[model samples]
Target: NCIIAASDYYLDDDGKKAADLYQKACEFGHPDGCKWAGWLYMTGFGVDSDYVRAIKFYDVACKADDLEACVNIGFMFENGAGVDQSYSAARDIYHLACERGALQGCNNLGYFYQEGRGVEKDIRKAKSLYEKSCNDEAVWGCNNLGGLYYKGLGVERDIQKMLHYNKMACDRDLTIGCDALGAIYLHGRGVPIDYQRALEYFQKSCSNNSMLGCSFLATMYASGQGVTKNLKKGLKLLTRACEHGSNLGCNLLKVHLANEKAQ
Candidate 1:
């Protein structure tokens, strides 16, 4: 019997056992196994990074009609992770996936149109695609649409609309949206600066796994902005962020340490 081991290892905590087991299950013909194995290989969470192998597994999974795998393949092509970077190729794959009703694919396809990547720049098209994804409850799509409204990209700048979509995504627990909104509130962008609100949003974002949020929250604590100065807490938060791969956190920690040494 093929081990239904994918979900178990997909958390992928301690080590290579996760990636290895996923691959083993994949070899035994588990379609989900192929996708998970490909994901681990691409990210190198518990195994050596292997873009070629990642693509191969994704291709197999995609051929099995796994739309998510198809989207991953498109992403790999878009970034040239293992193969030659080809925006056209990425666009084609994304188009195929989007046509098949993959919301992520539609969002990425919107990005391509917005950025003029391998396709003619078409802000209206981008807006349409983003709206399609967002209406379908893709949080990233809502975030992107918010950015367009905020920047007036192919639409008149509309702060209310921007906040509406941003809050929509943040309410859904998307860390990026939370962090962005937190920064906006902290800086008074399109609204009065509200350090208390910033603290709440940053705290929410950080607790939900946003490294940047942790870094900003650490800054707030260290600077005593609407909160008591707590160097110990700040340092601990920064260290946590760094361990989780936030370069901003690492850099800030180094800066603070250097300042203390200078003192």
Candidate 2:
């Protein structure tokens, strides 16, 4: 398909060629082509960022029953990107998408319920929605459900359940879940501490781009908790984590730098 080829070209950094192909596909009334074109415009990949034009193409794809396009429209409304900020509108769209079996929409709606953003704050409803999303295989939904279980919000406190859900999410390759498992093992929350297990979980999370995991692993390395002490390796990991926006990593790196200077 021209759209698929366009995507390949885009991934290869031939934005202009991709845009031309996408435009051709869009002219053929391919909904996905229109969506891709909109994305390119929205991100300024192959063209200038034009929120207005992006909205137009997205609207077209959404009208064609593209679920992702509807979600994108909801995001645009929620963030006031090329449109008026209207949480109410976003909520309506998400509700529609959820009704159509979009798990991401269910997860987002659960968040709104939890935070009282567009809907009334209802922890019970949030829990139920999260359960539905998790059942639908949304990893973030499982993570959120684990958090609720851990905090005993709208459900009885159940550490076992929390661990179960978090582990399930981690097994599915969610970095946040891996980070949670690492923390649990590191601190002996519900079981005896196992520094080696904690280190492995943190390593998995860090490999998946979790800055918090990198920070924790760096600390362990620095102190030789589970691995051989290597201050140089620790400092490098800490620096990487900080560069990736971990405030804890940044703070720890600063302390380490100051201590090294003093020595």
Candidate 3:
């Protein structure tokens, strides 16, 4: 299909060609073509960024029963992109998508209920939605559910339940879940402290791109908690964590660098 080819071209950085092909496909009434064209316009990838035009194309695709387009429209409304910001509108749209069986919609709607963003604050409803989303294989839902269990929000405090859900999420390659498990082992929260196990979990989390895990692992290295002390390796990990957007890592690196300069 021309749309698929256009996507390949876009991936190869031929934005102009992709945009042209997408336009052609749109003329043929391809729903995905319209959606991708709107995305390009929205992100200024292959065309000038124009929220109005983007919304127009997205509206076309949404009318064609493209659920992703509807999600995009909901995002645009939530963020006030070429439209008045309205959390209520976003919630209604997300609800529609959820009713249509979109897992992401269910997860997002659960967040709204949890935070009282658009709907009335309802921790019980949030818990139920999270359960549904998790059952539907949304990793974030598992992570959220684990947090709620840990905090005893909408459920009784259950460390075993928290650990089970977090482990489930980690087994699925979620970095946040790995980091959480690492913290639990490192701090002896519900189990005896095991520095070796903590290190292993931290390594997995860091390799999976969790800056917090990198920072934790770096601390272990610096303090010789589990492995031999290696300040150089610790600093390197801290640098990487900082580069990946960990403010704590950045501050620690800055202080270390300053101390080195003083030395």
Candidate 4:
């Protein structure tokens, strides 16, 4: 009912109606509803953008001690949305959510340690937290862990392990992971040159809407490395990739078309 009301209010731009339903839901102990109200206020969705009110609603939900709300508070503190920036406050909220087994909290903590945002730079701790998040099936964590391994950040330079983690993340449907793995395979890093595997991974990434993936898959098709030469199909994919925000795709597609015209 609250969802329906929110949806209806959204369609009609009825700020008062949305606020009323959100208030009722919050009063009923629905932390999610409270969080949504906070978001609505924060983004000015059907209401005037009010960071103060957003913070108030988030504070109310945080007081309920929900892990998600704790994470939101961490974000708020980290970004100083409605309050003064306080790394300590962000760290505490992140810790609270981590204690509650929120994988995202682990990932955020890893980011904090990596960037020394609120703490000293500790690559070891960052890797540990990322590993924990990956174990919890966090795709972002797994993908970033693969990057860490690739960069040898606080870990031994093990290219094979990098590919392994990239493959793991890609198999879990992470487009970035798939694109990274495709690059690794294409360059024969940590493994023998396997354009077929690279093509497959790039295709998977492209299917997931990765511009780089589409561009690279087009390259492979044009080169006839992993598949037969098909300029028309390759050009189509390149155009699509370019439309999807890849300047590399646009440049390559232009070069390809020019070469074809010359031929």
lDDT of the candidates, in the order given: 0.89, 0.87, 0.87, 0.84
* Candidate 4, 70-147: lDDT as tens digits: 677788899888889998889878877887887778888888898898899999999988888885347777877888
Which pairs clash in the backbone of model 3? none
Clashing pairs in 4: none
Report the candidate with higher lDDT, 1 versus 4: 1
Best by lDDT: 1
Best by TM-score: 1
For each of the candidates, the C-alpha root-mean-square deviation to the true structure, in angstroms, is 2.2, 2.4, 3.0, 4.3
**Backbone N/Cα/C clashes per model:** 0, 0, 0, 0
Among residues 3 or more apart in sequence or in different chains, the pairs in candidate 2 whose N, CA or C atoms overlap within 3 Å are none
lDDT for model 1: 0.89
Ranking by TM-score: 1, 2, 3, 4
Stretches > 4 Å off in candidate 4? 1-28, 34-62, 72-90
Candidate 1 stretches with Cα past 4 Å from truth are: 1-3, 12-15, 135-137, 258-263
What lDDT tens digits, residue by residue, belong to model 1 across residues 88-108? 999999999999988889999
